[model samples]
Target: MVAPLSAWPWENLGNFKYLLCGPLAVKVFHSWNYEGTIEDHWCLHVLLICALRGLIHQLWSSYGNMLFLTRNRRIIQQGIDFKQIDGEWNWDNFIILQALLASMACLIFPSLNSLPLWNTKGFITLLLLHVAVSEPSYYWFHRFLHESNLFNHYHSLHHSSPVPHPFTAVHATFLEHLVLCIVIGIPMAGSITMGYGSTSMIYGYFAIFDFLRCLGHSNVEVVPHELFNKLPFLRYLLYTPTYHSLHHTQMGTNFCLFMPLFDAMGGTLNSNSWQMHKKISSDSGKNGRVPDFVFLAHVVDITSAMHVPFVFRSFSSVPFSTRIFILPLWPFTFLFMLVMWAWSKAFLLTFYNLRGYLHQTWVIPRFGFQYFLPFAMEGINKRIEDAILRADRIGVKVISLAALNKNEALNGGGTLFVEKHPNLKVRVVHGNTLTAAVILNEIPKDVEEVFLTGATSKLGRAIALHLCRRRVRVLMLTLSTERFQKIQREAPMDCQNYLVQVTKYQAAQNCKTWIVGKWITPRQQNWAPSGTHFHQFVVPPILAFRRDCTYGDLAAMRLPDDVEGLGSCEYTMERGVVHACHAGGVVHQLEGWTHHEVGAIDVDRIDLVWEAAMKHGLRPVSSG
Candidate 1:
């Protein structure tokens, strides 16, 4: 005896039960039999529904950020801007392409196997399974991406943003998106094919998946501490916004999507993740206090394995001929690298705050190489921008572009940062002015004349002008006298009269003071003239001949008196030297300039520069 169509719903579709499944069962049931041809009738309708879901998600994401930022900016993670999307490639097109592909995939998935319209479970069960499986699958796949060669070639795009947003959740490669479908799709498709899911379950799957993706990428944090410690099992099943944001900021931690079970078991949990989450969630964002300026150092290289760990970095630091000796221990070295990566990933804090009485300073990991290399470094600007954007989100008042970081930035001197983000609250400074100020302060008062190298350089020009203003005759040294002298002649009268342009370093031998305005490292202690009080602005002082006679930095200029409530910090063996740009950042924040300062080193602005230096506790040149 054959069963009727209505009877089939109760008999064939059994076990799981849900009230929401009624509409889905009816829709699919009627379409398969009563409609004669399901394709002609429901294709456009399904497409329309998919488009609406996409539109709704985008609108809701924007609305959510504004609502939260208005009520409390603290709860928000990366804010509303999409810095990661502002690259060479068009993201909107890619996002649209992905959505269309996903919709197409959805249409194709159901047709492959006729599913039993079973109302197996409610919306709650659907939510639980996606979270439980999504993160574990995401955990292993993401780990593979970072650990393999694909990191630089492809995965770097998704990791570009230090802070994630809802739009960024889908900002991945087409291949990656397809792989994601397989990773996230197979489980759901299996359950439905086995007569466990109804029409509502499929809808529930997409709705929950999209939401958690946005929630994982969003700046908001709703998972409280009590949920984790009070109910430990929940820790295995839930993930907070703070969890994923950290993965973006500091790579190699919190890789799971909605669960921490895999990450904890895999030894990739960030120790400071919870504390940072608490800080972000608890902030009132109303206190009018001076925020810290975060600085990230340049990494040694972008195209090499040096960014991973000390071992990997050290291994690549050597010559290839010498590197061959260590090749025999590849297996052992790999194991070591894995152990170190796990320990560091689990416990290390990549950022630190150097606090003073008046203000605070933050420093992040090195993104580029340790020293300046002649090779072309691609994708570095984006990395630096990510750090700057991260700093902006945390409310950094000023960002100091340090060392080679200044030269590597967009058009150098942070012009790219300020131009790209006109309304950005975090101020960008090259620290050139304050550096010039420190170098200028090192000049001996008794000298009648001084020799300035790199006279065409911004720092060189500033120092020359300061010397001329002080009535000290300036001898400008450059590689080309004809071209530079013509350029130098255009300066104000007060500067031209006291300046003499030459094209040789030997001209400075007669002068009592020699300031290497360029980034020249010293090779020999007696390289300078015997009595010459030579000051070097380039770091890692080539020669520390004498504290007062041959100073090696502009940032650590010792002041006679302390400003604000901080102590006077002179260039010493114990305290260490501060970068001129970093010191300048302290000054810029205290001075509170009216306009943006790309690299301010004007002679007129020298007065406050000195005060700003003193406030940061940098003492003037002291003879040890």
Candidate 2:
């Protein structure tokens, strides 16, 4: 199985691959600072050109993956997995290598060093060379790579992504990319050698090259049908996204790089290309398919704004954490937050399929801190209500409120929406019913007594009532005796004694099991006994203060193995695991439950929801 091509030498460097061009960049800058003019500086021009290439790729990646803008027009219905994301992480590595090579070429050749800033003649020569030599050569070379051994080693890497992303255009083996450098260089080298080369022409050509490359792999149908119909020859001259996508999926056909004329000449053109293009582009209209469930979520922090699927695919695929690269993007993200606060609406984030049903995540355009602002409450509630009503209009069967979207202080856990629109079809769910079930189930069945914090909140209240029914002692911690008595009154008279109201952390020192529904600092955590295990349903999970005492994650559930296209993790949760509330919504849709689960967590439905989740293959995440 050993093949001709191998990995790039800098492949192991990860983010440090950019460092490969450091020496050359320093040389170019030093020369530019000393020299009077940069018009004849080949190295500096090469560096700037390479930087533009990377920028172009990044712009397309971000724009193409924005689900709210491009979901319906997406050529591929399938989702990208973690493996594809990892492979494409260093897609811009080739640009760095190109810069290094071009610098070396400048050093080797005296003629390439003195190119002018503009040359109409050189631009024409470059275009002719690209059309006459580069086009046909790349066509056959690309076709040759599909041959047995070459395909197995070199070409398959590029074809690995079934749903082609913008970066997928350059995600290839080192040897394959080396050949690509030659294909691109022929035009530039040829124009310069003939004394017709210019700096502007080089910039112009590479920009077009990158733009076309990104366009082909963007996975969204952007080219209109009327243009091709009005000028039919453009079909063979220019390849669309649907055209390139067929090559990745079918492999044998559409061997041309940017032009499909070679495919037509080689008798490899798929007849269905234009028809498929029309269908996909038309589908991007208002008649597109509607999802069955939508999980409405909001950004948690400034860093979290970039932890979305569209921002950076690889970063979003795993558990979200602040990274060094993301630090540089903070200012841009902060500005975006301000814009969202002023003019944003609920937008699509990501989506996946489960049991033939479409489920999507929609983002509320506000940060977590904004939800805590008293002045923003009305605006936040209006956004949530608008999203709910929109989902109802779209025929969504279930729409789940996530985190602060369902805050009791603002909208009574989605009760206000349901009450206002009593006849709405889409079931509005706060999902705390299953949130309580997940936290309660994490407790060992044999445990008799447990300390509970935020004991009067919706989830805490449900847990207290459910545990008391099982003859377990519930040490409810809250300062409001009136709220505690109100919750306790709901329990049966015989089981009311089990729900004890304790006002201090000292009351829990004797208890080995702690259910944390609110944030607890290290000082408060010290009150727990040495072996006390903390089970929390808190956001931004409390720090692990007690090394001796284990702490459980925020209640989450591992999706069923049958779940498809689940590429990104939910916040800090690991891949394939989502918060228990999101799982609750899925379970609601699967069980065909018509009732809206809002306001209070129904104590009676705790076991019923848990069993239904288990029946449908949703398993509780381990408490650690």
TM-score, model 2 to reference: 0.96
lDDT of 1: 0.56
lDDT of 1 by residue, 560-580 (tens): 233221211111221223456
lDDT of model 1, residue 609: 79
C-alpha RMSD of each candidate structure in angstroms: 20.5, 2.1
Which window of ten consecutive residues has the lowest lDDT sum in model 2? 35-44
Identify the candidate with maximal TM-score: 2
Could you give candidate 2's per-residue lDDT for residues 1-624 as a string of tens digits?
A: 445456888867877888888876777667678875554467667778987998888889888878888887888887776778877878887898788888788878877776788999998899889989999999999989999978888888888876798889999898988999999999998999899998788899999999999999999889988889899999999999999999888888988978899889899999999998887877678546789999999989899889987788778998998889899999999997788767668988889999999999999988888899999999899999999999999999999999899999999999999999999999999889999999989899999999999899889999999999999999999999999999999999999999999999999998999999999999999999999999998887899988889999899999999888788989989999999999999999999999999998888999999999999999999665
lDDT per model vs. reference:
0.56, 0.89
Candidate 1 clash figure, as a count = 16
Give Cα distance to truth, residue 235, candidate 2, Å.
1.8
C-alpha positional error of residue 127 in candidate 2 after TM-score superposition, expressed in Å? 0.6
Whole-model lDDT, model 2: 0.89
| TM-score quality measure for candidate 1 | 0.44
As a whole number from 0 to 100, the lDDT of residue 102 in candidate 1 is 45
